[model samples]
Target chain A: MGEFDLIARYFTRPPRPGGPTLLGVGDDCALVQPSPGHALAISSDMLVEGRHFLSTVAPDRLGHKALAVNLSDLAACGATPLAFTLALALPRADPQWLEPFSRGLLALADAHGCELIGGDTTQGPLNLCITVFGEVPLQQGRSLALLRSGARVGDDLYVSGHLGDARLALEVFRGQLSVPAAVFDAARARMETPTPRVALGQALRGVATAAADISDGLVGDLGHILRRSGVGACIEAEAALSVIAARDALDAEQALGFVLAGGDDYELVFTAPPDARAAVQAASAHSQTPVTRIGRIEADAGWRLVDAQGRALQRQDQAFDHFK
Target chain B: MGEFDLIARYFTRPPRPGGPTLLGVGDDCALVQPSPGHALAISSDMLVEGRHFLSTVAPDRLGHKALAVNLSDLAACGATPLAFTLALALPRADPQWLEPFSRGLLALADAHGCELIGGDTTQGPLNLCITVFGEVPLQQGRSLALLRSGARVGDDLYVSGHLGDARLALEVFRGQLSVPAAVFDAARARMETPTPRVALGQALRGVATAAADISDGLVGDLGHILRRSGVGACIEAEAALSVIAARDALDAEQALGFVLAGGDDYELVFTAPPDARAAVQAASAHSQTPVTRIGRIEADAGWRLVDAQGRALQRQDQAFDHFK
Candidate 1:
């Protein structure tokens, strides 16, 4: 089928009557209505073949990860999914590839009540670009928006879910490491379909001072929150290492490196007032997503990792730099 | 600079207080507050190196056209520009290229009051994916949104601005034709930096029954409107030829082919009631964009081109298809 025909047959769907979407695909533009008194949260992300994923990766998994990464951005801002547009450039019109990709993409979208509103398909190297729109309700006499610059000194730093599994999967894929078959499967799933903490993020509204989604490793991503908030952090090495799913699978040194600097973890790293610890725990319980306090926001100007004995640990790895 | 630093230096901007944008760059997601009681119009377009434009094209013009094509989609829906996100992939971080690109992009955005909200910058083959957000106000108790399916039998079909110049420029670039230096320059400008016709579209809101932007040529794009509206049209060949800026430079048949089936025009082709002709004219006058009555919508299900004496014109070229 041609580009337009392919979209019409697979991606286009009738807009749900009385839904936020007034118009969907098959037009010059898609129309949506933002809920009254709510601000729309928008983010865009692009994934290129080789750079973002392997050619042998399942199309469905690739599709899921593509949208999930963008949704993770919204999650960091405490917004609920609304709709998204996918601009896909494919080498050819292969139904085998297209079907599974759309299935994986829409399945996740359906789970979050996010609809595929509109997009464009073209001929090029395999590249997926998604722009997701979300709704953030106004609360507490201000928009209940979590920002990178909102973290304060003395705030307790927390992270959602286990870290390092996705990176472990990458190491396996790169043939640099080997793991038990079951462990590899679990880690691969984490890499392919890392869940966006949307529910937990919404629950943290009015609770967390600042938040960010971990994509480029915990330390590097957290550094964004620190740089923006003008705060420092002292991460408890043991606490951080405990959150790695493969903590017991690797040596202490290797575990520490992956826990702190391994990337592709879509968990939430946030901070809240020390007094709101119970409230933060309640949010975690409500969302059913595990949370652990790993560090403290500080007035000092740089971040460091400290061992259980309170000695600073040597840093070895840097964040993934796309341009580098 | 790295990807993040490149974004911060070139595209990031401070949010305007009390503007529609609640939060701009530097956040996980940009937050925008759509005007109350209006529907958001969103569209995405991607431009890839070698496929969409020549590498020799000016970076500034390339940037303007990238966003302009998306804005043209909004214009087709009669929506006012609001904000846009740019996801750009480049081979390397070259400040010389980025400065002009962002300058051109932001200048057009600033012209239409659209803000650069948020996006991603990565290292890869040069590609630009832009998702633009627009607002369409409700009118006459309905959303006042224009749709391709809204055309009716006997409606007067109109086109905004001149046509075929962009195609002519492409021909020259491909070494298929030559023109006077002045004509080449004008046509190249049209090809590289075609205006989106935003004002004209907003003005035709209540007057036009349906609208679409001419991107892939007059016949092919209007075919989309016809297919969706379940209507047909007989375009006047003489009138179509008249709109080609390079008409005098080519044979009648060649000019007709370019005017009817050439791509990259970026003009608006809309249908309106016969009684709304004056209103359409007024809209054109108000927007300072020319409008030409080129045909009439019909109940039949196929399109045709007729000469001034009412003889059917022979079809020559097909619309530009990316894959084919």
Candidate 2:
């Protein structure tokens, strides 16, 4: 089939009912209007076959993960999902793959009320890139889109939902470790389809001081927030250990390693003042995504690992970098 | 070098002065505030090596063409330039290539008053995907962004700037044809740096009834407008022959072929009612872009080509298709 036919049969859909998309696919460009008194939050992510996903992955899961990663950026900014465009390069147009892939992609989009507005597809090496657009409210003329620069000294550092499971799954995939079948399956699922935590991000909108999604391990992703905010932080091992969701089959050291430096965790790492602790907890409960206090923002310039008693310690975490 | 360091060294520039981007590169997501009463027009295009351009082309030209093609889409919609996101994958992090590549990309962005708000870079095969955002005005309850669905029977078809030079250059690249030194150089330049008619697109805004960009050759791209508008068209061969900007190097048949079916023109093919011919000419003059009336919208459902004597003729023009 031609490129146009491939898109029409598989990807084209009417814009979401009453959604921000004024016009969707089939045009030279898609036209969307952000709500009045709001700004558009945009993010772009590119995923290559071997770099971001294994060749063995199911197409549906790959589709879900592709959009999920971009959504995580929107989640970090506490923006409500609006729509996304996908630019895909494939070796060929295989119907068996396209069927489930679109199903998985649109399914998550529907769950988040995000519309698949427009995109391009071509025959080439397998690569997927998604650029997501979201809306953030304006507060007294200031956009409420959270940035990593808003953290202040002595603010309580928090992380939403769980982390480490996805990284642990990678270890198993690499044959560095093995786990029980159930644990392995669950960890693989986490790796393949990590939740985006969009609701939690929105709930913490005005309540949290600063935020970032944990994609390249807790310490590394947290480093982004610290560098942008020009502050340091301290992570307590005990608190961080509790943030690992798939720890039933792993020992304490392995779990700590995964929690500290393992990448692919799509949870939010945020900061809020001590006085807003109650408010933070309220947002957590409201969004139904658990929040953990694992670190504290500091006036110093570099992060540190601490024990349960708050004594500084050495680390085993290594953040993921595409070009190292 | 790591990914973050690479981005920091080469790509982390601030948003344009007084531009719409409230927050730019450093954040998890870029935040841009569109003017009130305007909608954002977004387009995404992917370029894979060996498919979109030759490997021998300079990095700077490739960079310019990447953004230029996307801008062509915005022009088709009559959208004003805005901030864009770039998602790139490279085989390696070579500064030698990146330095010149970024220079070409940003130079065009500055010229158009468009900002490179944010993007992602990863290690993979060479690929560039750009998601561009533009703004279109609203009139009453309707958006002024032109659509392919708006073409009506009896509308006069128009095209902005020139066409077919890019296709002629491709023929030379494939060793299917040869030309004089000056002709080859001019055609190659047109192929590499085809201008995006942004000003002309915006000027034609309310004047043009329907529009589309010529990427997959004139016939193929115009076919899109015809299908979307549920109307047919008739191309006058004589008027089309005038669109061959690089025709000095070729015979009449070859020039007509390139003009009729050559892809990568990056020009606007649009329609205006007969009564609005003066307005169309005014827009062309105002934007300093020449336009040619080559065809007319028809009541039927398929297109036809007629000779200068107004008689139907056989053809040799064939549109470019990736799969075919």
Candidate 3:
């Protein structure tokens, strides 16, 4: 089938029957009416082969990761996803691949309640760019957008979930690691299917002062907060490795190293006011996500990694760089 | 530099002062407040190396085309360009390439009155996607969106500008065509820098019943209008080739073929009711754009290509299809 025909058959949806929305799909442009009380949040991300993912990665996994990463960005900013448009560049029209990829994408999109409103399909090497739109209330103090520049001195730093699962998954994929099939499967799943902390982000909207998803490792990402907020952090090495210890993924020393420097975690790292520590604790228990207070922010010049004995460890700034 | 550092140095713009917008670059997602009386129009386009352009294509032109194609989609819907986000996938981080690209993109964006809000920069093999936002009045008849499905029986069909320049330019690029340096330069400009019919689209909003930008050639694209509107058309070969005839890009007979079957013209084509014909003529005259009546929509099922003498000629259903 032709590109137009394929789009019409699977993608087009009738305009939402309502007051504000006008068009949805199957038009040159999708028409939307902004809600009276909210501002529209727009973000776009592009994933390409040999860079974002390997050529041998499964199509379904690629689709899931593509959407998940974008959603994670919204999660970082405390935005609720509403709709998205995709621009797909494929080497050829392979229905078998398209079906699973679209299904995986649609499944996640449905789960998140985001409408796949519009997109474009073209011929090229595998590349997918997704632009997501979300909403945040506009009233002052009502809609607090999380920024990397909001960290306060002496505020405790926290990270959600475990780190380095995705890194391990990549190692497995590259044949640099050997493990049981189940372990391999679990690790691979973590890399392929990221869980965007959307609900956590919303819950922390008014609570956390600074936040960002860990796409490029904890140390490097936290550095953004420090540089932007004009503060520094002293992280407790043992506390950072708690997850790796519980999962038996690595020894305490190795886990600490990985958690601080591994990329593709897609977990939130945020800061709260020292007074909001009780609220942060309550949120951690209530939200059913692990939140570890790894360190305290300081009015200083650079981040410092401290051991249990309070000795600072000299470390290199190891983080993911797209160009690197 | 690392990704974070690169983003800090580039793609980081503070919120603009007193613009018709909300949120700027540097944030996780851009927040946009559409004009009070307008409905938001969105369109996206993806350009990939080896498919959309040669690897040697100037970075500036590549950036321009990435945004222009998306703007063309907005133009097709008779929307006013407002803001755009780019998702660039690059094989490597070269500051030289990025500076020129950003300059070109910002140049067009500034000229078109669009703000550079937000986007992603990722490592990949030369893939670019741009999503553009435009505004159109929501009032029913005052700001009608032109769709591909509004042609009716006896409605005149027309297209703007010459055809085949882009394809001819490609021929020259591939060393198949030997043309004068001046002509070659002109054709190359058309190929690399397409003039989207934004103004003409705005003018046609209230005057034309149906419309679309000619991207995938006349025959294939007109087929879209026919399929969606459930109508057929009879083309007067001589009349449809009139604009190209003036250009003398090809002989009258050859120009007729290119005008009907060639692709990437990025010109406006629309159908008008008989009663609205004079108004269209007047609008065209005031806008300094000629509105040619090339053919009429029919109530039948098939497109018939006919000479001025009314003799039908066999035509092939050949046009650009990404997945064909």
lDDT of 1 by residue, B29-74 (tens): 9988877788899999988877788999999999899999999999
Clashing pairs in 3: none
Q: What TM-score, over all chains together, does every model reach? A: 0.98, 0.98, 0.93
Ten contiguous residues with the weakest lDDT in model 2 chain B = B315-324
DockQ values of all predictions: 0.81, 0.85, 0.73
Pairs in clash, predicted candidate 1: none
Which lDDT value does model 2 have at B270? 96
Per-residue CA lDDT of candidate 3, range A1-324, in tens? 888777876566665556334777777788776666777778898887876777787878878888998898888888888888988888887888887788888889878877788888988878889998877777852345687888988798999877777777787788876667776687778788888888778778889989988888888788778887899998887777675422474555555666887788889999998799888877777667778888899898788888899999777757777866
Report the Cα interface RMSD of each model, rounded to 1 decimal: 0.9, 0.9, 1.4
Candidate 3 chain A: 10-residue stretch with minimal lDDT: A243-252
Error of 1 at B18 (Å): 3.0
Runs in model 3 deviating more than 4 A are A19-21, A140-143, A179-181, A245-247, A281-287, B1-10, B140-143, B245-249, B285-288
Q: Write the per-residue lDDT of candidate 3 for residues B204-262, one digit (tens) a residue.
A: 88788888888888877777788779999998887876756224545666566667776
